[model samples]
Target: MSNNPIPIVDFAPFLDGSAKQQTADQLLGSFKSYGFLYLTNFGISNEEVQEMFDLSKRFFALPHESKMLAPYPEARTHHRGYSFPGREKLPDAGDVAEMPLPSVKETFDIGREDDDSMLNVWPPDHILPGFKELCLAFYWKCHEVEKNILRALALGFGLEEEWLVRHHRMPDNNLRLQHYPSIPLESVLTKKVARISNHTDYASLTVLFQDNVGGLEAEDPNEPGRYLAVSPIPNSVVVNAADFLRRWSNDVIRSPMHGVRAPQDMVTEDGMLPDRYSIPYFCAADFSTVVDTIPGTWSADYPKKYEPMSVGKYMLKRLADGY
Candidate 1:
C-alpha cells in the first residue's frame, strides 16, 4: 500500500544511447543497493504483458488431467512444462529446513524453442490453440530486452560492452508463468505455511512482470529479517540480480532474497487471500559457458570468492535442490 520501496529506472535512455552512462550508473547502483529496480519503457508493451497474464490464467484454469499432459519432467536439468501446486519446497533465508511450508503455487515453464541443449515440454496444439506461437514470441521479446540490460550492466562494470552479452548468445533462459492460489491467511501469518518461502533466484538476472494484486516483497539489506513491499506499478517490470551474477561479480552485486505472501488489503472476509500471478523471465548463460569472477571484479585485496562452475552443472545442482 505504501509507495514502492525499489527505485525505478527507465530503459529508454539506454536504448537510445542518449543518457546511457547515467542510466547504467543508476541501474548498477540500484542492483548493488537493493538488488532490485523497477524498469519502464523496456520495449515490451502493456498490452503484451496483459496478454501473457491472460494466457497464464487460461493455462492454470485447465483441468488437472489436461494440464498434466505437459508435466514437469523428473530429470533435474529438464525445467520446462507444467508443475502442480506444492511441487516446490522453497527455502527460507537459504535454509530449507527452517521453512515448514511448501510453496503453494503452480507453474508453467517454457524455454527457448531453438535451445538444442534441452527441449521444452508443451501441451498439444488442440489443448491450447496459438499458445506456443504467442509464448515463443514473448520469450524472444524478453530475450532481446535482457540482452540490452546485460550490455548496460557491462558498461556499468567498466567492461567491454560485449563481455557479458557474449556468454548469453545461446538464449538458454527460462520463462516462468507462476500462479499462487487463494489460501487461508492465518496459516501464512502463523508461519505454518507460505505462498512462497524466502529464497534468491539462480539465474544471472530476472525480469519480472507481476499483476496489481500485490504480495511480492524484497528483503531489506540493512535489516536482516525485514522485508519491504514491492507494490505493482502499471506497465513497469522489476529487474533483480540473481545468484549466478552474484558469483560472477565476486560479491560486487547482490542476489536479493524475495518471496510472496498474502497482501493485507487483498484478504477476503473469509480470510482467504486472493490468487496472484507473475511472469518472470530468468536470464542465464549458455550451458557450456564457464562462469568465474569477471575481469574487473577481483584483485589481491579482494580475491576471487567462488570456484569456477559451468552453467549446465550449476543449473543442475540448483534445480535439484529446489524440488
Candidate 2:
C-alpha cells in the first residue's frame, strides 16, 4: 500500500480562474481521500495570525479570577468565555457519560456576525476596549474564508458549489480559541500533565489555524494506537470534514479522530515556543439539517437511520457531556 501524500489545494487556482476544471478535480481527490486538506495560498497573512496569537496570550494572562467571567456551562450562547478542563465531554464515543474525563485545557469561544450584529460576552469594558472587536474581526475573516472553502468542497463532491454554503446556519457558527499551555515544569517533574484524550471534532467542518507547535496527532490507520503528527505549515489552514459532515455524506468521508501529546513529541524550531495556542472555526449546518445518504454515490444506498436534529441541540448534548 502506498502512503500517498494528501493533496494540498491552492485556492489561488480557483481565484485566478486560469484552470477551474483542474482545480475542481484536485479538490474532489482531496475530499474523497482523507476528507482533509492543507489549504495554502489562501492569503491569510502571517502578521494577522501573529496578532491573533498575541491577543490570545493577553486574554490568557488575565488573572484566573478575571478570566472566570466567561466560564463554561453557564454561558447561554456557548460562545465566549473560558473553559476549564472537564467541562466538555466527548459526545461521539461510548456515551459521554462513559468516556474518560477531558484534559487540562482552557478555551475561549467566538462566533460569526450577522446583519452587522455578532453575539458576544463583553469582558466589562474599561478592562479591554476593542478587545471584542479585534477578536471578532479575525473571526469574520476566517468565516468568509470558510464559506469559500466549503464552496470548493461542494465542487469536489460533484454537488453545487453553493449547496452546502447556503445550508450553513449563518453567524451561529463558532470561532473557538484554546490554550494548551506547556504543562508546568513542576507538573512535568510530577508527571501530572493530562492531555486531551483521543477524539474527533463534532462540527460539520473545521478550519484550524494552528501555530508552529506540533502536538496534534491523528490515528494511523495502519498502526492503531500510534499517531501521525499533523505538522503545521505556516500560511495555510488545516481543513477537515467533521462528524456531521460524515453523516451528511452517508459516511463517504469520516471524521478523523485526533489528539495531542505531551511536550516530549516537540521538535524544536526557531518559531516554536513551549506555549501551544489554537483557534479553530467550527462550521456547521443548521441543527435541522438531516444527515442523510447521497443517492448517486454508491450502488446500494440505504435510508438514513439517524433522527433529525438542529445543530444547537446536538452541540448542547455534546458540550454538557463534555466534547
Candidate 3:
C-alpha cells in the first residue's frame, strides 16, 4: 500500500574490521523489522550486473522452440533450466483458494556447475558466445557476497562469526533469471494473475538484482492487507531473510511474504507494460545440513516451531508444492 521503509546499509564496513558491530546491529534491526534491506558497496561491479542482465535478455529473446530446449518439470528434478510462462503457480501460503491464478513469468535457473548431481543447463556456446561463462562468474560472485552477509548475520545472532559459514560449505544455492513479459491492464484485472504470486522464499537468504521497472512488494509487518513497494536502487542488491532462516531462528527473525505486480505507471501509450527483469541468487545451506533453532534464539516460552529437517528435503518439497 506504500513504499518500503527498509534501511539502506553500506556493506563496506563488514569487509573491514572497522564498525562491524554497528553493521551487525543495522542488519539485525532490519531483519527483525521488515526482513528486507538494500545492500550497497557489497563489491560486485555495476558493469558486471549490467552484463548479466544483457545476457538474460538475450536468453529470454530466443525463439520459443529454442528456449524450450531445457524445459520445466524435467528440469525441475535437476533444479535447473527454463520455465515458460504459466508453468509455475505460487499456491497461496495460507489457502489455495485465495489466489488460484498461475504466475505470469518465465525463468531460467542454474546452480554451481561443479555439482555433479544438479548440472546447469546452458545454451549452446555457438548460439550465445560467452553466456555460460558470464552466468557462472556472476553466480560465484553472488555466492561470495552471500557468504560475507552470512558472516555478519552470524554475529548479529550472537554466534561465532564462522558459525553459518561452516554449515554452508556445500550450498545448494541457485541463480534464477526471471522475466515478466508485458501484459494488458484488462487481462491483469480480469484474471488476477501476478507476475509472481505472494510467498516467502524457501532459501536461507535471497540476494536480488532488480531492474528499474519495479513491481516488488513486501508485506508490512504492522498492517495486514497493506504492502510496501520495494523500488530498485541503483548499484544495490535487495537482500531479504527467507523461511529457512526464520525456521533456524525459531521465528526470532521473520521471512515476510513478497510478490511482483505491474506498477500503475508501467503501461505505455499502447497499453502494454514493459518487461521486468530480475536476477535473484538464492543462498541456501548445504543439502544434507539439518536446520534447527540457533542456540540463543529459542527458549521454553518460545519453543522451536519447526521440526528438524535436511535442507534438501525441505527445498524439494517446497518446489513441488509451488508448481
The backbone clash count of each candidate, in order, is: 0, 9, 1
Question: On residues 236-306, what C-alpha lDDT tens digit does candidate 1 reach at each position?
Answer: 99999999998889989989899897799998999998989999999998878888888888999999989
Off by over 4 Å in 2: 1-4, 73-79, 89-99, 113-119, 184-193, 263-273, 298-309
RMSD of each: 1.5, 4.3, 1.9
Better of 1 and 3 by TM-score: 1
Per-model TM-score versus the true fold: 0.96, 0.83, 0.95
Query: Model 1 — which ten-residue stretch has the worst lDDT?
Result: 92-101
Judging by TM-score, tell me the better candidate of 1 and 2. Answer: 1
- Top TM-score model: 1
When 2 and 3 are scored with TM-score, the better candidate is 3
- Higher-lDDT candidate among 1 and 3? 1
Model 3 lDDT per residue over 1-323, tens place: 14458789899998887888789889978998889999999989999999999999999999988887776546455668888898788865444578657788999998988898787777677776888788888988998999999889899888899999987888689999999998876776565676776789997999999999998988889986677889988999999999988888888888999888668787888877789999999998898878777878878887778788898898878877776
lDDT of 2 by residue, 50-109 (tens): 899888888888888777776653644355566775465443232345446446678888
Could you tell me the TM-score of candidate 2? 0.83
> Could you tell me which residue pairs clash in candidate 1?
none
Clashes of 3: 1
Model 1, residue 276: C-alpha shift (Å): 0.5
